[model samples]
Every structure is written in C-alpha cells, then in structure tokens.
Target: MKLYTEDPERILIYGGSRKDSGEIRGIISGDTLKGSFYYSSYGGGTLKRYPVAMLKRENKWLLGKGVISIYMGIPSYLKTEPIDYSDPKFIFEEVKK
Candidate 1:
C-alpha cells in the first residue's frame, strides 16, 4: 500500500490487485483516522465505496466496528455484514517505508 499525507490531516492510501484497485481517503483527527474505502469490483466492473474508521494504536491501524458490503458470485450479489476487527483474517496494518 502507498500512503500520501501531504496535507497532514488528509491522507490518501492506494493499493490492490491488478484486476481491482483500492483506495482509502482518510482524515486524521487526534489519533484516529476516519475515512472511506473505495475499490473496483473484479467481476462487476463497478466501484465499491464504504465508510471506514481506524484508530492508531502503537503504530498500528486498528479497525473500528462497522458493516461492509461484499460482492459475491458472477452476477454480483452484495452481502453486508459487520466487520470482525478482532479476527486475524481482518488485517489493518500500516506499512512503513
């Protein structure tokens, strides 16, 4: 992932697969980062946008509780579910360069 924090308060994060690219536009307030996560659908050819809030703890970005819609199947069926931040599969790490 690539992060652009030129405005300090405003941050732009970009990264994903070749078929689908993801971008996150976040606003820094205190130690929290509030923003929207955007990505392109692999099969639907549509843009998926969702709200995301993360808190900075010990240099790691921890995801806030929220529901996200995930598209499944060929025709693109959306299933909205609560995000499990405590799960190891749900990773929200900030890479340092």
Candidate 2:
C-alpha cells in the first residue's frame, strides 16, 4: 500500500491488485488523524469500506482498531471511539530534494 496527501487533513491510500484504492479524511488532532477511509478491493476482499483512526507514531502511521458505526447510510467510526495505535501500517518518508 502507498500513502500520499494533498492536504494532511485529507490523505489518499492506494494499492492492492487491479485498480483498488482508498481515501482518508478527518481531523488531525495532535499526532493522530481521527477520520474515515473508504475502499473496495477484489484481491484483498469483496468489499471493505469503513472508518479509520490512524495514529502518527514516531516515523510511521499506525492503523488502529475502533468501533465502526453507520451514519446517513454510510459506515463510519463513531466520534466517541478512540482509535488505538496498536496496529501500524507501513508508510514512507521523502528525502529532501
């Protein structure tokens, strides 16, 4: 998977087989990005569209588990749920040019 952002508040996650990717958008509260991610992958699974709470660790962003709820017919992570940074997903770093 790969992560890039036009705005830190809005991030894009792309990867998987074929042409499947996801988007992340939320509030950046301190070192964590409390928001939602939408995705659907055929190689990874049938469908996976849900909310996410990624904690920005030292040098990596961690994908944490949280309680997912539906709002307005769309699945989302409850604002009350605190995303834990126990599970981190691989990201990257850019060397200054």
Candidate 3:
C-alpha cells in the first residue's frame, strides 16, 4: 500500500513532536488496520519492533479514537507510524483492495 503521513505539523503526538518524513510506510490488512514498528530506547537492547494499529484519528492521537490513536502517535516512543491519508493507489490497493 502507498500511505502518506498527514502534514507533520498537523499531525502531533502526545506533546507536539514534529514528526519526520519517511516515518511513513505502507502495508495491507483485513477489515481493520494492522502493522508493526520498532520502539527504541537509548540503549540498543531496548530497540524492538512490535505490532501496532493502522487506523485513523478524528483530531489527534488519543486512546478514545481507537485505531486512529494508533495512526497519530508515531513519535510517542510507541514507535507508531502515520497512516496514509488518501490516494487512489493507497486506498484502492492498500485499504480497500
């Protein structure tokens, strides 16, 4: 799938960390969003990737938003990545298929 991260400025995590580009990646899943990413600590051993939600948020990353919260909190050390907003290639191939 071809997912594009929302405008970094518009897409803020817990505090307001301006996310970087390329943090975005695309993948395909079932009825719901699904994927995995790495959460790293200062220590090398702490670096490990795990499954994360591939959903969308109404405003910003918040637990109340469910999957969407997963979409917006890419830099929260949760190691989440922003889901692509919209695109024929991404929507048709990735989301809808």
Candidate 4:
C-alpha cells in the first residue's frame, strides 16, 4: 500500500493487486489521524498491525485511527498524485513482516 496526501490530514491510499484507491480525511491529533476513508487496504489486514508509520525524509509518523474506516474494491475521490511522506519500502516490509 502507498499513502500520499494533498494536505497533511487529507490522504490517499493505493493498495493491492487490484490497485484500488481510498481517501482519509481528518486532522492529525496527537499521534493519530482521526478520519474516514474508502478502499484502504491497511484498514484491517497485515498493514493494520501498525496503525502508524514514519513518513519518508520526515520526522513524523502518520497515525490512523478513530472512525477512519475504508471501502474496498473501488476507486478514490480524486485521481491525482499526492505527496508520499511515508516510506514505501518500509511500509511494504512492515505489512509483509
């Protein structure tokens, strides 16, 4: 899964062999993002084991929680490339591990 954002709190998630998409919108409170999303592969599978992960070249981790749910097997709201703060390689490894 890959996560990027136009805005810090507004997120876009790309996941799975189907390459489905999802969105997470909310504010970053403490160490978590309290939001809701669609097609988020990490919502409940392997990736979900780690609710948060450190962003790439950044000193912070994006925490996901609250009503931050997801919709699968569908497309996201927008189809633009967002900022990829989280480390893709690390995330992939985290999920696989």
Candidate 5:
C-alpha cells in the first residue's frame, strides 16, 4: 500500500481548499472512468501526480477514493474502484473546451 497525505475534505473539486489540482486526463472504460489527477498544497505549490477513478452511473460521473504514492520518480495516478453515490461531494462534469 502506498502512503498519501490527501484528505478528502481538502480536495478542491469538493469545494474544499486547493489541495488538489491536476490535468484532466482520463479514459472511459465501460462504466469506469479512469483518469490521472494531481494534488497541491496550501492553495498552490508543486503539484504531485496521482491517480483518479470515477464511476458512471445514470449518466453522472461520481468521484471515488484511491491511493497516493511516488515510486521510481514516476507520476502515479489515483486508482478508484467502487462507486459511492450515497452522498458525493464532487461530481465530475464535462470539461468545456
């Protein structure tokens, strides 16, 4: 298991502090949305890369939880498995280009 310092309450996507900021790069596989997100600190700073996984339910992309770590100096994205739509704090929408 990889160790991470991310608190779900501090994620920006959930109206929390700017604790997470990263490039929206993901692929929709079946009902699973696999993507790569990064976390920041104190509103702004060096962005650390991590993984992100969301579940598509009823045409809505909901957020999930995953691990955070750095191995071999590679940007590891967040890996989320399971859909928790019980009371989601953040729902990923279509990124306007």
Candidate 6:
C-alpha cells in the first residue's frame, strides 16, 4: 500500500493486487487520519465500503475501530470491530526509499 499527502490535510491511499484494488481518501489532523475506503474485488464480483481511521504512533500506523460493509454478492454482511494495532496484520509501516 501507498499513502500520499495531497496537501496538509488531504491524504490519498491506494493498494492491491492485479485483480483487486482499494483506495481511500482521508483528512489528516495532527497524527490522526479519518477516512473512507472503497474496494473492488476480483472479477468485479464484490464491492466493499468502510470507514477507516489511522493514527501515527512513532514509526507505525494504527487502524481505528470501524464498520465495514461488503456488497455486490449473496449473503453480504457488515462487520464492526476494533483493529489491534500491535498485530502485524493490522499495523502498517512506512515504505523506505
């Protein structure tokens, strides 16, 4: 994933595979960013939407609690949970050049 700062307060985040990709638009304030994410799934079979917030702490980014909705498929569901920042699966680090 990559995150770009469009301005002082606006951020653009994007990443994914060849068949699935996602983008997020966020507003930054201090060390926190609040945003929404839209995802396109493989074969264009599913779409996902979610509210996301990230907090920069030291060298890592932590994902905040939010609700996600999965659509465009049968038996879609909504999930609400808090992201565990200490978990590698939920934490993000900056990409070094």
* lDDT scores in order: 0.54, 0.60, 0.33, 0.36, 0.56, 0.56
What is the model-wide C-alpha lDDT for candidate 4?
Answer: 0.36
Tell me how many residue pairs clash in candidate 6: 0
Scored by TM-score, the top model is 2
Q: Whose lDDT is greatest here? A: 2
Model 3 Cα lDDT, one tens digit per residue, 10-96: 111322333222232335454344444443332234444444344344422211112233345433223254444343111212222
Estimate candidate 1's alpha-carbon lDDT, on a 0 to 1 scale.
0.54
Please give, for residues 45-90, the per-residue lDDT of candidate 1 as tens digits.
7766666777677777776665544445222112354444564223
Q: Model 1: clashing residue pairs?
A: none
Model 1 is weakest, by summed lDDT over 10 consecutive residues, at 70-79
Per-residue C-alpha lDDT of model 4 across residues 58-96, encoded as one tens digit per residue: 443443122222247332222243434343443421222
Better-scoring candidate (TM-score), 1 or 4: 1
Report the C-alpha lDDT of model 2 over 1-97, residue by residue, as the tens digit.
Answer: 5554444322343454344445665789888776666655533555556666767666777777767787777787777867666655544443232
Clashing pairs in 6: none
The 10-residue segment of model 3 with minimum total lDDT is 88-97
lDDT of 1 at 8: 33
List the candidates' TM-scores in order: 0.50, 0.58, 0.28, 0.31, 0.50, 0.51
Clashes of each: 0, 0, 3, 4, 5, 0
List model 5 lDDT by residue over 14-63, tens digit each. Answer: 34323444355578889987766655654477876666667878766777
Q: Point out the worst 10-residue segment of candidate 2 by lDDT.
A: 4-13
Model 5: per-residue Cα lDDT at residue 46: 88
Would you give me the overall lDDT of model 6?
A: 0.56
**Candidate 2 ranges with C-alpha deviation above 4 Å:** 4-19, 39-49, 79-81, 89-97
Residue 61, candidate 3: how far off, in angstroms? 5.3
